[model samples]
Target: MSSDLVRFDATRLAGMIRAREVSPVEVVRAHLDRIEAVDSRINAIVTVAADALGAARAAEAAVLAGEDVGPLHGVPFTAKDSIDTAGVMTQRGSPIFRGRVPEADATSVARLKAAGAILLAKTNLPEFSYSTETDNLLTGRANNPWDLGRTPGGSSGGESAAIAAGMSPLGLGTDLAISVRGPAANTGIVGLKATHGRVPMTGIWPRVPRRFWHVGPMARSVRDVALAYSLLAGPDGEDGFSTAGLGVDAGVGREPSRPLRVGWLVEPGFGPIDPEVAATVQAAAEALRGVGCLVEPVRIPALERDDALEIFWRLHVMEVKPAFAEVTRGREGEMFAISRAMLAEPDTSVADFVRAEQAAERLRDGFADYFGGHDALLCPVLPIPAHAHGLSEFVINGRAVPATHSLSATVPLNVTGLPGLSIRFGTSRDGLPIGVQIVSGWWAESTVLHLASLLEATSPVRDLRPAI
Candidate 1:
């Protein structure tokens, strides 16, 4: 029974709770039990909110008392540790902030709670939520439930792992580069990176590169993701960048009038894709075509530039340097080893930042031009499937490249502040999950999600789960 509850997505659980078929306490307990049973091996949860059961009890009483409830009332969810949780530990997978707890929930968390979602726990992340692999000196690593020896993808790795492993039904994760989408693609779930400033980021850490950062939903199903997206999006008037509202429904409506036009690229003008990964993307394009969409191969030449990563790195490093410096000022030894090394590196010059910014502008314009003709771009979220632990670089098609290069396909959306949605499309030969990215123009989340839902209805991996 507990296993079944954990397996049900948030939307199903919400309906059950609302119908009085299940009490919030029962729902929370099922998840808590699942966490206690599975989290030791997964290490996905960093802190189980101490008052989760209390909140669930209150939800039960409210339901019994006939109080009006929100769409997600009594549903359990988790937040990435990098987001403030109001009395729960938000260590950010770094010893630098070890044992630290926030006094206020991040805007998204507060909104979700207000909508009647129970805060179950905080999930793991890379140290300071910095890397693509979720490991740090503070809370160790979050292993892939699909293959314990492999990674679940990082920054939001824990959230993805937890949701994939049925430890959490839904989660909140922040994305600056590929944080959320990478993990979603790696873990066989749905992760939506709404347009820049579409969701408030009032209490998420590493606020530098503020314009590019986004906080969105990561869930087992697109419907649940849409539900959470509606709850969390829009400005709270606190974050300067979050001034724009998410102007459309959470991509839950009908298909477009005419056949949608989608452009796909497996190589995506970046890293070499493993043949299997490439095959899955090709299969996705074919599937879109199978579903009555006009699918074609289109390449944005700007993405092919070798300097793309350099520009992202330069801009990222410049933006985060102050935060890194201030945090590591006297407590350098407490920082993640990678972060320490990164901070010790010499800073980029003004000329380099300026050039990178200009490059970013060109890249953004290039994508804008591409989107002018394409409703969405279909591509691989990563060049390869989830990999083994402690891998510093991935050998794609025999040539070794920096592991962070995995972010190549997804980072362009971040650079342009466009909305990108990742959904499971197919699986690798070894049974690991493989996903395709659907990226749309700025504020086009509804369009992307609508198309993604159409694809989800036909995805072979839609109902699949890791055999953990």
Candidate 2:
């Protein structure tokens, strides 16, 4: 029963809980037990909520009293450690803030709580949430549940690992470049990097480069991600960037009025993509076409002309370094390898910063042009599947590339402030998960989520669980 409960996605769990077939206590305890059984091996969870059961009991009482409940009533969800949780430890995966607890919930966390979801726990991340893999001096490292030697990707690595390993059905992960989608691709799950500022960044850390940072949902299914987005979307009036009104429909069960035009790509733009990963992107395009949408192979010249990953690094370092320097002023020795490496990088000059900003605008304009002719874009989430942990270099399709190249496919969306979704659509030869990215124009997350649901329904790899 516990195994079955753990395997259920958040949408199904919420339905079952509302139907009174599963008690809130039963649901919460099952997850807690699952965590106890599996998390030591994965190291995904940094802190389990002590009052989770108490919250569950209260939910059960409300249900018994025939009171109204929220969409995620009694369902359990987790958040990356960098996302503040009221009364819960949010150490930001760094020793500089060890034992720190927030007095209030982040807008995302508060919204989930408002939806009746229990805060299951806080997951791990790299130091200051600034690395490609989930490891920090505070929480050690997070291992992929699929292959213990591999990573789930970071800074949302622990969140992806937890959901993939059945430790949590749904989670919140923040993405600056590839933190949310890359990890989801690595672990074979669903992650959404909604339009920048669509979800507020009121309580997340490292707000220096607030323009690039985004808080989003990572889950086992697209519906859960869409549902989470619906609740987490509107502005809280605290984050200046989140002032945009929530106008997208979320489109879980709706279809487009006309045939949706989608363009898929795998080369020239996103650096060296593995052949297998490229094929997976092609397969997804074909699947969308099979579903009666207008799908074709397409490319944007901006992606090929200006490297999105390079632009991201150039722009972010200018803002990030000063913040890191301020936070770690006297505690430099407490830093991890990733944080130290970031601090050690050559500073971005004024000329370079201005150039990158101009390049970013060009990238956004490029996407705007593409969207003028298409409703959505389909592409690979990562060039390859999950790699062995702690490696800073990689060779993809016989081309040597830096580890930061993994962010190539994802950073463009961040640079453009576009919405994108990552869902597992294929398995690698080594039995790893391969995810395809679905992106749409600004404020068109409904289009992204709509197409994702269609693909999810026809996905060949749907519901394939990791054998952890």
Candidate 2 achieves a global lDDT of 0.92
Q: Each candidate: what lDDT?
A: 0.87, 0.92
Residue 195 error, candidate 2, Å: 0.5
TM-score of each: 0.97, 0.98
Best by lDDT: 2
Candidate 1 accuracy as lDDT: 0.87
lDDT by residue for model 1 over 119-213, one digit each (tens)?
A: 99999999887888999998998999998999999889999999999989999998878999999989899999998888988998876658778
Q: Residue 230 in candidate 2 has what lDDT?
A: 91
lDDT (10s digit) by residue, model 2, range 250-278: 33236668898899999879868999999
User: Once superposed on the true structure, which residue ranges of model 1 sit more than 4 Å away at CA?
Assistant: 248-253
Q: Which stretches of candidate 2 lie over 4 Å from their true place?
A: 248-253
